[model samples]
Target: MAPNKDNLFGSKKEASLVKSNQLDSTVKEILASEQMNRERKTARLRELRLEKEALQPPPEPKAKAKRKTTKAQE
Candidate 1:
């Protein structure tokens, strides 16, 4: 039987390719997890903010200050 060179201890190029694929998969999973966590936190914060705002009375509108008219010098 011929020795299987393609298994575990394959050529450098093959090993590198395998490692690259594994790294890519790992990085993709990490990014997805972070994104999901960020979204969940944002939603929770938004809900809390909405609840707080609803409980608070609406703010009264402030009156704009009238600007003093400058007299033209002759």
Candidate 2:
């Protein structure tokens, strides 16, 4: 009987697919962590800004100007 041979591309394809999947998962995890950190920092900065605004005095209101009378108008 002739000797059975392994698939030329089958094993290679499976190994490549496994490596690709691992790489993809690692990249996704890293991106997720970065997103979380960015959101947390944004929230903290926003809170600090709000606190600062609360401690500051409000602006004074400006008075409305009176209109001048014209000679043409009796």
**Clashing residue pairs, candidate 1?**
none
lDDT of 1 by residue, 1-74 (tens): 56786664589898799999999999999999999999999999999999999999999999999999999999
lDDT of 2 by residue, 10-66 (tens): 576788999999999999999999999999999999999999999999978988899
Q: Candidate 1, which segments miss by more than 4 Å at Cα?
A: 1-8
Residue 3, candidate 1: alpha-carbon lDDT:
72
RMSD of 2: 4.3
TM-score list, all predictions: 0.84, 0.69
What are the Cα lDDT values of the candidates? Answer: 0.94, 0.89
Poorly placed runs, candidate 2 (over 4 Å): 1-10, 62-74
Residue 45 of model 2: what lDDT? 100
